[model samples]
Target chain A: MEIRTDYADGNYTIHVDYGILEASISEYIAAYSSVHFLVDQNVYALYKDSLLSFVQHPIILEGGEASKSFDAFKHITETLLERGIKRNHLIVVIGGGAAGDAGGFAAATVLRGVDYIQVPTTLLAHDSSIGGKTAINSGHGKNLIGAFHRPKAVIYDLSFLETLPHHELLSGFGEVFKHALLKDEETVRTLMDATRTKISLDMMKPFIISGIETKMHYVTTDEKESGIRKFLNLGHTLGHAIEYKYRMPHGMAVMLGLYFMMYASNEKAARNIFDLDSFRQYFELHGYPLEHLKAIDEVEMMTLMGKDKKNQSSDATGFVLMNDFGQCYFTEIDSNQLKKYISQLKESL
Target chain B: MEIRTDYADGNYTIHVDYGILEASISEYIAAYSSVHFLVDQNVYALYKDSLLSFVQHPIILEGGEASKSFDAFKHITETLLERGIKRNHLIVVIGGGAAGDAGGFAAATVLRGVDYIQVPTTLLAHDSSIGGKTAINSGHGKNLIGAFHRPKAVIYDLSFLETLPHHELLSGFGEVFKHALLKDEETVRTLMDATRTKISLDMMKPFIISGIETKMHYVTTDEKESGIRKFLNLGHTLGHAIEYKYRMPHGMAVMLGLYFMMYASNEKAARNIFDLDSFRQYFELHGYPLEHLKAIDEVEMMTLMGKDKKNQSSDATGFVLMNDFGQCYFTEIDSNQLKKYISQLKESL
Candidate 1:
C-alpha cells in the first residue's frame, strides 16, 4: 500500500528512479547557485561512476561508523581548504547515515558554515539523513560533539536499496518500526499485517516517506530538542547507553530500548492499539529478544545516560514518553523513578 | 566632534556618553529585546540589577583570560540547558573582550547556532566588541580554537571604559593602533597628534572611531579572517608571542609586534604607512614599551603561529603585511621570512 502524502515545507524529496538523481542535483545547485563541488571521497565512492555523468566536483572518504570521527573531519576540512572552496561553494554528500552526518558537520563548522546537499543511500539513513542532526563522536560517547546544521536539500533514491542484505533491510525496518510505535498506530498495524504480505523493495517507498513525514513533524515542533520533541528520545535514552554498552548498532539499540519502555508504561492509548503479544512474537521471528534487561548493568547504564546531551542540568534528564500514537511530550523524570520503571519491567520479563 | 553614525543596517545611536561607569546597558537591551544572556560574573556583579530588568535568561560566568577556555564553554552550555533556551533565543554578553569572545563561542556552538549581542565593558573590547571573531584559548595557543560568529548587535557604551585601568587602556589601544595603520590614515595621524595634544578621554573619540571603522571595514570584507583582513595581523603574530612570553596585555604585545614588523620590513607599504617616527615618539610619551624584545626566540614565535587558526596548513602560515592604507592581503610567508624579518628588526632596534 503506497501511503499518499505531501510536504510543502520543502526539505526532502524521495526518488524511486535512477534517472532523476543528476538532474535534481543540478537543479538544486542552479537554484542555490553559490558554489560548485566534486565529492572526492568516502560514500561519494559508492556513486563515483554513476554520479560522474552528473557532478563536476567529487570528494570521497572511507565508509563506516569508525570514519565518523575527528580525524575524518580534519581530513575532509583539509581537502576543502586545498580546493579553495569558500562559502560560495557547495559540498555534496551521498551515502549512508555516517557519511551524511560527518559531511554535514564538517560543512557547517568549516569557515563558520557553508552549504551542502544530502543524497542518502541507506534505509536506516532515511531517518538519519533528513534531520539537521550532524555530529562527530567525542571522548567515550557516540555523537558527543555535533551541530544542528540543516542540509541544503535531501534527495533520496529508492533504487539504491536493492543491493541490501536481509539484515540491512531488517535494520532499516527497525527505525520505521520506531516511528510506528511512537507516533502512528495504524503504522504499527500496517507493518505487522504487511509482514504476512510481500514486503518488496518498491513496496517501502510509502513507508519510508511516512517515517520521514513523522520525523519532520517532530523536528519542526522542536528543532533544537528543547520542547516536546524530547519525547522522540523515549527509547534512545536507555537505547543509546545500551548501544554503547552492548556494541549494538543504533537501530538495534533503539529496538531493545523500545521493548523495555513499552512494557514499563501503563498508557491506555498505547495499549489499545499495539499488540504486545504480537510484537514479542515478531521479535522472536526477527531473531531479536524481548528479554535480557538483566544483561545490562543498571548503575552503569544510568551513568552513560548521565552523559547524554539531552540531560544538561543537575536535577533531571529530559525524557520522551509515548502517551498516544502520534503524540508525546518532553518531561523531566526522576532518574531514580526511571531506575524503578526499568527494574519493574525486568521483573515482568 | 561627536560623530553619530549608523551602520546603515540598524538604528543604533552612538553617544557622547560619560565615563565607562556611566554606560547604560538597560537602555541598550530594551531597544533590542534579547532573549538569553551569557555574561561574566564580575561584570554581572557590577550590573546584575540593570541586566535582570531586561534579559529573560541569564548565565553568569567567572572572569579571566583562561576562562575563555573550553571549561567555561561547558559551563555556559549547561546553563543554557537549565534555562531551556533553544537556537532561536538571543544571547546577550557583557564583560571584557574575553567574556564576549568566550560567550559568543558558547552561543554559537550550543544547538549549533544562536543569536548573540555584545555589550563590551573594557578598553580592549573596542576591537573584540564589534568583530564577529569569537574564540576560546587552548594550551596550544590563544584564539587557536575559535569560530567566526557574528554578533546580532553591539553596544559600545563608553561607560564600560571608565572602570578600565590606565595600563589596560594602553594595552587595548595596541589593537586600535593596528587598525589606524592598516586603514584609517587620518585616525593614525590624529592618534599621533593626540600624543602632542592633551590626551583626554573625550578628546580621543575621532581616533577611537577611526580605528573602530577601520577594523569594521576589514571585518566586513573578511569576517573569517581568511583573506584581506590578515593585514590587520601585521604585528599580531609577534605581538601574541610577546604576550605569551612577557605575560603582557594583548594591546601592549601587539604594539611591540608592530614596532618589530615595521622595523623589519622597510617595504614602502609596511614602512611608509606604519610611520615609525610617530610610533617611537608616541610610546615614549605614553611611557609604554615597558620591556624590550631582547633575546626573544623568533623560532618559538613561529611555532606559536602554527597553532594559529589562520595557518590553514602545516607548511604555510599567513601574514597580512600592510601594502597601503585600506589595503591588505593574506600572503603565505614561511618561518624563514619571519626569522629574517625579526632579525632585521632586532638589529635596527
Candidate 2:
C-alpha cells in the first residue's frame, strides 16, 4: 500500500512493497531521475535493482563511513557537472543515513541547490530523510559542514531495508529509542513490545510517524537547530566524540553514551524514564557494546564536545540530557561537571 | 536618501547618491550580508573608506568577469571549505551584475543555498537586481550556467554608477527603455524628458521603481521565467546572439533586437506601440550605432536560438514579443518569416 504521510510543513510518502515507486516518480518532472548525486556503492548495488527498475539514471558511488568528506562532495559534484545534470533535473539520493546527508547536501549545493528526493534504503533514514539537513565532513566533526534544504519528497520503500545488516538495523533503533525518550509515549511502549527479529513495514508505521513528528516538531520550532531543538542531541555530544575517536558506528556509540548519561544526569532529571536497567539490558541483549565508553579517553571526549557545532558559547557546552520520558532540555552542562561524570563513569566501569 | 523597494516576492533598497562612494557590508546569518561568499576587489578599492564590514571570516579574491566562473566557484568554495563557513552564514556579494549572479549561485549551492545579497553598481542593474536569476557563463553560452536563487535583498546605490563610462550609461538605459516599452509609462516619459547628462539620485528613482515593478511582475508571475515571464525577454533572443557574436554589451544588442523586431512585427502588433523612425532617431541622437543589423547572420542567429533553454520543443522559433506597451506574449513566429525579416534587415542596412 502506498501511503503518503502529510504534515503542515511538508509531506513524505512510503512506496510500499511493490510497484508504487514508479507511480510516485511519475508525478515529478521527467528530469528528476537523471540527477547523479554521489552515493555509496555497496548500498547502491544492493538497491540498484529496485532503483533502476524505477530510476532512469543511477550513479553509483563508492560507499562507507570514510566517504563522508569534502573530497567526496567535489568528486560527486564534478561527476554530476560532467554528466550535464542541469538545475532542472532532480538529484535523487538513495542509500543510508550518511548517503542521505552527504548526497542531499551535494544536491542542495550543486548548481546552487537542485531538486532532490530522498529514497532512504536503510533503517536509519527515518530521521535523516525528513529534515532538510544535508552535509559532508570537514576534519572537524560529523555534520560540521552542511545545509538546511528540505527535499522535494522522500520515498521510503520497505523492500530496500531487507539488505540492512543486523547491526545497522539495531543502530537505527537507537533513534527510535530517542524519539520515545524525548517526545511521545506510544513510541516507548511500541519498541518495548517488539518481539520479531525483523521489523516489517506494518511494524514501522507509528514509529515513522512518531519519529517524523518528533523531528519536524523540532525542525519547525528551531528550523535552524539553534536553540530548543538541540534537545534532539540528547546522547549525541558524547556519543559523537566516541564515534569519532573509536571509529564506531554512530548508533553503537550512542548506546554507550545513553547508558552513561542515564547516571550522569541528575537523578530527578532521569526519573520515570525508561528503566535504565532495561535500556542497558535490551541493547546488551541485542549484542550492542554498551560498555565501549570505558575504553575511550574521557577528557578528550569531553573536550571534543566543545568542538560540537551545537556549542553556542565557549564556556557552556550543550547537552540534551533527559529528565523523563517525553521531556528533555538542550541546556548546557559545564565542562567541569561533564568531566566529573566522565571520571565517575570511568571509575564505576 | 535610502529608499527600499519591496517586490512582494523579494525586496531591495536604493541608496541615493553621495560623494566618496560609500559602500558598507554588515555580515549576518540572514540571506543578505555575510563575509563568507563575495569577491569585490574593485569595489573594495573604490569604497573601502566608507564601507562598514564585519564577517565571521573574510577572504579576498582577484576580481573580474572571469572571477565569476565555475573555477571561481571552486576557489571560493574551497576557501569556504578551508575557513569553515557553516551553512548559517550568508555570502554578501557586492558589485555589479556579474558578481551578483555568480556569487549568488555559489552561495546557493555552497552548503546548499546560503543567503546572499546583491549590491548592484551598474545602471543596467536596475532590472537584473530585482529578480533572483543568477549564473556563471559556460563555453556553451552566456547565462547557460546558472540557477534561480533570489537575493534576500538588493542595495542599489547610485554611487556605483560613477565608475560607468558614457557608453555604459547609454547601454544601461536599454533596460530603462525595456521597462517602459514592456509596461511602465512614467519611466519612459522620465527617460525621454531627462536632459541632464548626469542622472541625479532623485531623477533615477522613478526608473528604478519602474524596472523593479516590471521585472518583479514577471518574476512573481513566473518565478521560473518560463511562460508569461519570457515576455520579459522581449528582444533578448536576437540580443543574446548579438552580444555573443559581436561581443557587444548586453543592453546594446538588446536595443538593436528591439528595433528590428518592432519594425518587423505585424501592424496590429505594432500600430502606435513603437515608432521605428523615432526609435532610430532617439538612439542615433544618443550616439548608438544603427548599422550593426547589417552584419547579423539570420541563419546562424536562428540556429543559435533553437538551442535557447526557453524554447520548449523542436525546430520552432519563439519570441517574447509585444502586442503593445504593457502587453507581451511568448508567441512562436514562423521560422521562415523570422529568417526573412532578418535577411531583409540585413539587406536594407
Candidate 3:
C-alpha cells in the first residue's frame, strides 16, 4: 500500500510492501546524484550483502536508543561533511526510530537542510516514520532537540518484521494499541481480533497500514503539532517520564502510561473505555512492562512528568486524556489529582 | 523600513527602524503566551536594564563565534527544558550573528521547533536576522550543522549600531559591499558615495535596508538556497576556508574572499568591474583585515575550500564568480587552476 501525504510543496509517500527494498533503493539512487546510507549496525550485519549490492558506502551506527545522542549526531554530520555531502544530496536512514531520529536530524541540519528517506527495520518505527519529527535526545529528556523535517519517502519493507524479536514486536504493538484506542472503537475491535491469535508479519500488514493511516490523519492536518497533532501524544506524557527514569523502551513506557491515564480518568469520575478485562488480559499475554511501575515511586514519576515539554507550568502536568474513546482532550492535572490517580493504579496493580 | 517575505505559511517581517525595540518587544510578548530571551552576555551587560524591562529571566550566552558551538547548542536546549519552555512559547534572541545562530537553532530544535524573534544588535546582524538559516558549528567546519528556520519577525533597531566597535562597523560593510555588487550598479554607486564620508549610524540605515532587501529577495524566491540563493555565497567559499583556518571574523573574511574572486575573474581574461581604486581605499580606511591572507599558504586555503558544503568533489572547488557586476555564476575549478589563480593574486598584492 502506498500512502501519499499530499502537501503543497510536494507529495510524501509511505510505501509499505514486502520485498520493496531492492526496487525502491535503485529508484532513490536514480533521482539523487549523491545518496548516502546511514544504516543501523545490526541491520547492516544482517543485510550487508543486500545493501552493499546497491550502495558501496553506508555509515553504520549502533541500532539501539544510545545511538540517538548529540555525540552521534555530531559524528554523523562530520562523517557526511568528510564525504562531501551537499544540501541537494539524499541521506537514506535504514534503521529503527533511533536511526531515523538522529540521521533525519543530521540531514535536516547539514548545510541547513537535505532530503532524507526513512527505511524503518523495526516494527516500532511504524508510527515514528509517518511523522516528520526528527531529534537527538538531551540529558534532560528524549527528543528535546529536533525539527519538523519530512522525509522524501518512507520505504516500509514488511519482510524485516519477520526477523523482529518477540519483545520488539510487542514494542510496536504498544503504538498499535494506542492508535486503536485513540482512533475509534471499530479500530480497537479490529486490533483485538487481529491479536486474538498469534500475531505474524503477514497478519500484521492491515493493522500496520491502519496504524499509519490513523497517524497520517493527524499529521497531514497538523504537520507542526500546533493543534490536533497534540492528540497523537496520548500516552507520551507519563510515558516519557517512565522511559527516562527506568530506561524502559519507548513503546512499553507508553503502554504503561496508557494504563495510568485510564486509571486517572476513572478517578476523575469519567467514563472508562479501558475497564474491559480483555485490555488487561491482552497486555499481560503480550508481556507489557506493567510490573516495572510497581517498584517506581509515585513522587519521582510525578516529578519527571512535570518536566514534559507539553506542560504549561512546572508544577502541573498536561495530559492528552480521553473520557471516552475517540474524544481526546488536553488538560492540566495538579499534583494532588496526580497522587490520587497514582494511588488508585497502585492498589489495582 | 518594513520588509515582508511572503512564505506559504505566513508573512515574515523585518522591521528596520531607529528606537523600535520597546514597542516591538511588547508586540512580540502580546502574541506569545510565554516569552524567554536568549541574550548575548556582552549585549546583556550593556543593555540589561532595557532587556529586563521586556523579559525577566533571559538565558545569557557568551557573545561572538564561541556561542555557535555544539556544546552551546546542547546547553541552550538543557536550559530551555529546565526553564519549562513549552512548544507555544517564544524565544527572543537579542545579539549578533553567533547568538542568533545558536539561539535560533536551539529554538528550531527545542520541542521540535518554536517561533523565534530576532532582535539584532550589530550592523552584521542586518544580514543574519533576515535569513531563517540557524546553526551551530561542528568540528569539521563552521555552520556544518544547522536548519533553515526563518524568524517570525526581525526587529533591527539602529541604536545598537551606534554601540558597535569600529571593526564591527567595517565588518558589516563587507556584506553590504557584496550586496551592492550583487544587486545592481546603482546600489554599488550608492554604497561608494556613502563611504566617501565618515560613516555613521544614520548614513548606514538605507544600506542596511538594501542589504536585507537583497537577501530577502533571494530568500523569498529560493528559500532552500538551490538556485538564485547560491549567489549569496559569492564570497563564502574561500571566505569560510579563511574564517575556519585563521579564526578571522565572518564579514572580514568575506571581504578578502570577494577580492579573491575579483582577481580570479580578471586572470581568466574577464572584464574587471572590480577595477576601482576607491574600493581598496575604502577597505584600508575602515581597517578591513587584508594583511592576514599574506601569511596563509595557497595550498592550505585550496584544501580548506575543497571541503566546502557546496563542492560535489573533494579535489575540485566550486566558486561563485562574477564576470560582470550583478551577474554571477557557479563554476568548478581543478586544484591546478585554483593554484594558478592564488599565485596570480599573490603577485598583484
Best candidate (score: lDDT): 3
- Candidate 1 lDDT at B106 equals 75
Over B3-75, each residue of candidate 1 has an lDDT whose tens digit, in order, gives: 3333444323333344332234454445432367666777777766653344444577778586675567656
RMSD of 3: 2.4
Per residue, candidate 1 scores C-alpha lDDT tens digits across A1-349 of 1121233453444443445567767777875434545342554555556644566656665675765765676567666655555455677777777788887877776655677877777788888876688876654567655677777777776656777666667667778878777666778778767775434465676677777777777777667676766766767878889888877767777877877666645432346334556666777677555565657777788777766767654345556666666666566667787677667666666
lDDT of 3 by residue, A15-130 (tens): 99988987987787777778899998888888777633565689988777777887787789889888888766889998888888888888888888889999998888998988
Q: Which pairs of residues clash in candidate 3, taking residues 3 or more apart in a chain or in different chains?
A: B132-B150
Off by over 4 Å in 1: A1-19, A26-62, A181-183, A197-200, A267-273, A292-294, B1-107, B110-123, B129-132, B135-171, B177-193, B197-349
TM-score for the A-chain in each candidate structure: 0.86, 0.89, 0.96
Cα deviation at A7, candidate 3, in Å, is: 2.5
Please, what are the lDDT tens digits per residue for candidate 2 over residues A250-332? 77777776776676665436454556566666767777786776677766886677666666445556777666667776677
The CA lDDT at B15 in model 3 is 90
Lowest lDDT sum, 10 consecutive residues, model 2 chain B, at B19-28
Q: What's model 2's TM-score?
A: 0.78
Better by lDDT, candidate 3 or 1: 3
Where's the lowest-lDDT run of ten residues in candidate 3 chain A?
A: A269-278
DockQ measured for candidate 1: 0.13
Query: Between prediction 2 and prediction 3, which has the larger DockQ?
Result: 3
Worst 10 residues of 3 chain B by lDDT: B269-278
Ranking by DockQ, best first? Answer: 3, 2, 1
